[model samples]
Target: MASPRALPTPISATSFFQSKPTAHSLNSSSVSKNLSFWRNGSGLLQLITLGSTRSRSNAVENSSPTQFSSESSQISDVPILSCSEATEKLRTTRETYESKQQYLAMYSSIFGGITTDPAAMVIPMDDHMVHRGHGVFDTAAIMDGYLYELDQHLDRFLGSAAMAKIKLPFDRETMRRILIQTVSASKCRKGSLRYWLSAGPGDFQLSPSGCHKASLYAIVIQDLSPSDNKGIKVITSSVQIKPPQFAVMKSVNYLPNALSKMEAEENDSYAAIWLDEDGYIAEGPNMNVAFVTKEKELLMPRFDKILSGCTAKRVLVLAEGLVKEGKLRGTRVGDLTVEEGKKADEMMLIGSGVLVRPVVQWDDQIIGDGKEGPVTQSLLNLILEDMKSGPATVRVPVPY
Candidate 1:
């Protein structure tokens, strides 16, 4: 893996303040004070009353209705509500506010003062991994208010950290507690959680010994909607994956993966499939690639260059049934040519985001009938069923 780059700058959530204040009294000192406080704080006071009717009535009478309407109009532009929909608008606003507050509370509870932003939490740069890209991360889906495969994901994360010589700040059980607390606090029962660790900030040198501390963080993101599962096109990239010395470890250094993804995006494809230095098939930028032969064998590239994907492992387990029934055969990683993939009976990319989406096209060549093939469809169904039931114990479930 390449050395880690400077962490990306954090993104803010200030767009929520686009709404203007609604029509309310500001003539009296109390009303003015409330308005001022709202402007500085949450601006809730602007939508509510805080004083006696006499004061409010006096402020309303003295205030221009036109001005109130104009202010209300500006606030109405928020797209959340209109003056005619004040009651509903207020309710929605409160709900949104409460949700954000809950998310923050959860983050604080998990990592203490280490972080608070639920979007782009940061670990200091002095950590060894920050300077050397010596840590790992794992993410899993949350559905119906329950975290999915929390334990399995954490196990992978810890293993990667150890591979890079970074120590975990907490044990598996402790980390699980923090993850649950963070997820619950965020009120993100229906989202994805990204749990990552970094060799805590250290000197600017590449040596791992300089890094004494490690940082762990979890981010809860909105879940993928069904609409997002639509199949995507992919293109083969000229870039080759540098075979990892520790192919099974998931590390922070991902420039090669990022570059491959950028190539796919630039070409308007869903993903980029890479080749190895030997001109054999490797994998997608962030997923495992699989193809079904004319003989109905399920073949995957050996773990030579890409990280071993948890989703890919699950799919392999599910394929065992088919293999035993003589419906399919399982083949391990080996050199596979691009021609083989293009001419296969079926092909699909599996990962956390893409799942088991069939490859409708590879570049301009149509894959199979240029639609989802039987093997791809069946595998997708089996994986979905497994996920819905619960984590597959044969497969690891990282608890958080």
Candidate 2:
């Protein structure tokens, strides 16, 4: 190997770093030579030179073995590209090599832009929602070119945004039209539609006052795994539920809910259900809990301290027919005890993603003869029927 100059000494904040890493100036010849050296295998050379500039989180990976040992003159081997040169290099490389996996249409209100190009679904780093959890979001299912309960979900989405103190970028009707337009642009028939109301991008600060305005974004997702109506098991969650004010807001602050779900999966259950501080059955991480009493009454926990679930509310409404038919004597909401829930004739979880799911077991105890009970399945069929051929009051057809 050819010999090279000694490496530049490490620069501390008070030392040559106060100026630049290359405090030692080079002649035109040396600069040309350095630039040439950086053209190939220069990633390693810049590692030491730019170490102080990059924070610890900028983790770079180099799977291939290094060509030279530490004894090599890294400073001499590294090239120093001018601003223009670096920009051109990066732009060319990014154009040729950097690409994202394909996605359906996405709409962003920041620039009032909607595009199918996955590359265009970008957000600024300074968004308060990105840094300070100052945003709210909601999703509605798309089936056979119909938007399922979009109005209800949007109502909740707006409600959450209000609770988060994030104002809508547009009026309610305009927002609804935009949502439908976004979904229609995606041209997806069987998938999901997820959208967000963000405290718009601005200075990275604790308060969102600096934000220009709130923004809305929407995207389409393909949910191939339709609800199978299979029975699943759940356990009482140990994670603490959020206070009523924050809990009802469906904001992006979901760490606790996520942990609760993980806790259930870790324990070999389908989902985790939380309990109030007083030990009343609260709700699941992302769903609601309901039960068919031995006396044939359908009961659910009050929405006072939880996110008022859209799907749960719809189930309650749809279950009214069962009430008139004498299948369910009545349907109502109240504080439910865990002990009462474990002894119910049937239990089911309700959510938009899962229309209705039978709960056969809770912890180690069997729920109602250890089988998916009749009422649970009946309600599941009802929800499914509403989805496929429900009245226009519940389904919104996509223009595409």
Candidate 3:
């Protein structure tokens, strides 16, 4: 019989890492640094070895091959973490990085409660909304401890959910209370509240037939950046617009809109304007497009083929005041052509995010002397004033 093969010597985790040959040690330096950093006096257990100490020697030998057997073998040192380890890693990772947008609070139906910790403000990986894009969402701004257009945005939110066939997790009143309570928990005075309705957590699949139930999630974002109403440029989008059926709902399927926005940025423009199938002016990626005609008439595209903007509708109502004051001849919502829009006296993009942003140029054509128009300025001022001290119908106080 052949002599018994010599068993490899058992090695501790630290020694195993140090003994790796330089030629095969592609990530040895990073692994050593990570080990050093994590092995500090935290009293945490060292990396666990699989099987018995003697049998694991073979595992170590197999893991660190003489040479990389495949591209994936180059990553052999990755740790298999437990659930608690993963959670701790997530917390530390979040603590180590800086984010532009600060999330103050989050409410999730999955846990049936609110959380102030950003690390805990996570959705389930298997949630249909997370994996499959089967969700609808809406937002309302918080001004002076009050939610602006809460009911208006909430109505739109429910409407979008209904259109998407996602049932409500709770009644509208309960959701409203939950949202207010979430903002209250955050103690955020000047920010925005965004919420979503989805088919809930389930296995990863194209259909929601396997979902357990519907879900609702809300988040309060702290926004301290001052608003800038300066004029911006836009380009005609090369990306095709979504069909009217999908465009009319505020669903989470915004790939086309995102691509159009990216195309605009690639061309040194602020937004890309989409045209309807019939080639009429549709809207911006996330905002509605409006124009001031040569006759001083405020014109916008009909909402039948695009997302019905809350801010745009409010602006339309507020424009009536401008009309009464002779600032505008009148306000009209209908199909508008590119020639009609570009040749107009002024153009503006209206949405909750942008409020009333002036458009200085469309493609190469300058809009109305290439400056922010008086109408756009007045509109932005009107919106700001409304948010600060609007009627009870528009602003809902958060009883924190």
Candidate 4:
């Protein structure tokens, strides 16, 4: 078995939950609707499945909403709007594009500037990414008017582009600025943002030389509702993640992850956890896994077989502080067997979008009485508190 990373001290359950800030006053209903639309209809999920048959037909025959007044003003030249103005603009846009058809058209207009009918958007008959899966992408959450960890995400995005041998035209700083501008243009404060860089329209051939320049697009989406934060049940699937040389890349090739998630859903689970060939826990479809032992040690898989998640890194840092205080034992990331995870006192999954979600059950086995474990809840509280408190560094204002 591969040795685990050097362990850090453990954290106490009390301090973890005690530090979290109270929830913000955002509208829960609106957030839910927006999340559903973005996650189910937009390119986020489509990139994984490679196509969305159901949404394509609805996208057709819909006119793009006249949001933003077709103003050709550049972001660098335009003045940034106040929070109130941004919020009002977004509300007006949502009201105008209430129908699914209009929303699809609006998505294309605002994100990609592609005016094709919605039906044409999902007609997977084209080879683009669906047929050959030649693309790379990254997603980051916009919280409290700031894009969280965008620089880190961009680094990972560039790595994925290199892995796929895709020539991304935009430099990191330029792309970051564009992402912030896109968010400001959408007037979304607390939501998600996805940046997809795909090999330009290509033929059915597998070679990258046939593809033209890469295409970049971004979309701002609403945040997850509190209801989704209640915690979720998970199922361990027989499907295992194969260790490819490109395992670290978050490329468009996600069939394994998709299939694993589908299997979990079929078994009535919210997410799927896959094991590696050696029967060691790998990770969830889109999140990193973490567990707390009875001795209060934080455990996770080493980065060798899983994506180095930004949220996971932050959590580890928080855990380190707890260890320093001698509240818990330590943090460990290595090959954790299925039996070890099942036997853990607490378990949770972390992601940029979800933050931290407790796992009540793994497969049929109840993990720590099959409810939100005390330690898991504590860690989540700590993370929430950290997010609510602004970062120490001064935030660079987003250019309109």
> What are the root-mean-square deviations of the candidates from the true structure over C-alphas?
13.8, 10.0, 10.2, 21.0
When summed lDDT is taken over every stretch of 10 residues in candidate 4, the lowest stretch is 1-10
lDDT of 3 by residue, 179-209 (tens): 9999999999988999999999877889999
lDDT for model 3, on a 0 to 1 scale? 0.86
Residue runs of model 2 more than 4 Å from their true location after superposition: 1-102
For this target, which candidate reaches the highest lDDT against the unseen true structure?
Answer: 3
Q: TM-scores of the models, in the given order?
A: 0.66, 0.77, 0.83, 0.68
Residue 310's lDDT within candidate 3 is: 94
What candidate 3 gets wrong by more than 4 Å, as runs, is 1-65, 69-75
Scored against the true structure, residue 56 in model 1 reaches a CA lDDT of 60
Candidates in descending TM-score order: 3, 2, 4, 1
What is the Å distance of residue 299 in model 3 from its true position? Answer: 0.7
- What is residue 243's positional error in candidate 3, in angstroms? 0.6
Write down the lDDT of every candidate, Cα atoms only: 0.67, 0.78, 0.86, 0.65
Residue 32 in model 1: lDDT = 45
Query: Which pairs, if any, clash in model 3?
Result: none
Order of the predicted models by lDDT, top scorer first:
3, 2, 1, 4
Q: lDDT of candidate 4?
A: 0.65
